[model samples]
Target: MNEAIALMKRHRSIRRYKSEAIPLEHVRLAVEAGQAASTSSAIQSYCVIHVTDGLKRKKLAELTGPQEQVRRAGAFFVVCGDTRRHRLLCAREGRAYEARMEAFLLAVIDATLFAQNMALALESQGYGVCYIGGLRSQLFEVERVLTPPEGVYPLFGMCAGVADESPMERPRLGAEAVLFENKYPDDESMLGMIEAYDERYARYIERREGAGRGWSGSMTKKFAEARRVDVGEYYRSKGADFS
Candidate 1:
């Protein structure tokens, strides 16, 4: 295998970390690596804010709910999908700024790519990392704390530091389940594979994370809730005018 693929295969969602400070040079280099990721149409519509203040980090921990990793990690970053700056640029150039769903999606895609690239870069350098999706749970609180403009909002938060524990590689469904030649696989075949994966993943979680819930079980429990907790209105409030 090529060195890059081998490095990628070693990825783990690290939560626990050593309590040492990360060097400023390493943090700066990681951000540079994030910028190296592919961007949609060269728009590069993303921004990353490193959270260094102890009080702010603690508040962020509250915003994230039970994910204490944000408060404990050596470094934390708030990655954002940003189009406000681009809109200002357009205004300065006497052009109309695009503010549709397509534009919003592109910015969010760029932000995710940047964040994943940063994770890969940090992992390659022996740093452990964990992504905090809980930041979206209380979008308005996050918005208030970050003070993002009308066209910008926090996508997710990330924490990185030296490893305190080694996690096992999780299992994935084989190519038969996910990969297809030309057309999508038959429904029966897909369902069978997914069912098999659920059982396997359940065992994996029980063995690894001590969580008995498997993939489908875990997913079902989350989705079976009668009410949805997503912040669609909040996104709309952030100037997203979707079709």
Candidate 2:
């Protein structure tokens, strides 16, 4: 594999980080690389906030499932989908900016692309990084802290620093399970692939966590009931329009 590809494949989420701080210049360069990611209609509808305040980091760590990595990482960043800038542009030009489902979708995709690019860039520089989706667990509480504008909302958080530990890369589904030819595979073929992966994943879980709960079982339990159901309301509060 090529160097970049190998680097990507070696990706692991590092939770334990050293106290050493990453240079602000390095973080800026990584974010600049993130800006090079493709955006929808060149909208570039995303913003990153580096949380430097010690108090705020502790609060955010509490709000996000008490994930100490948020507080301990050398740098913490909140990635948000921002349509507020476009709204401001519209106001400047006397044009009405409409918030539609398409706008919301575009912003989300653009933000995700930007974040992944940033993560890759940081990892390439030998910094360990982890994404914090737990921010969504208490989105409203997070808002009270971050105070994003009406047209912007936090999608996730990220932590970056020198790693204190090197963890094995987690297992992933094989290409046969996820990749498709020109057409989608039949249900039986898909289920067979999943069953095979489940067995492999169970072994990995046993080795890693001392338990063997299969992937499907965990997924089923996790999704059996809707989580963060108020997320739609949270988005609506941010003035996102699905219509």
The lDDT for every candidate, in the order shown, is 0.87, 0.93
Q: For candidate 1, what is the TM-score? A: 0.94
> What's model 2's overall lDDT?
0.93
Please state the error at residue 135 of candidate 2 in Å.
Answer: 0.5
lDDT of 2 at 207: 90
* lDDT of each residue in 1-243, candidate 1, tens digit only: 998999899888899989987899998888889999999889999999899989888888998886788999989999988998888998999998766889889988999999999988888888999999888888888777788888887888999999899988888887788778899988888888989888888888889768767687777888888432657788889888687
TM-score of every model versus the real structure: 0.94, 0.98
Q: Model 1 segments beyond 4 Å from truth?
A: 209-211, 226-230
- Give a tens-digit lDDT track for model 2, residues 12-61: 99999999998999999999999999998899999999999999999999
Per-residue lDDT of 183 in model 2? 90
Pairs that clash in candidate 1: none
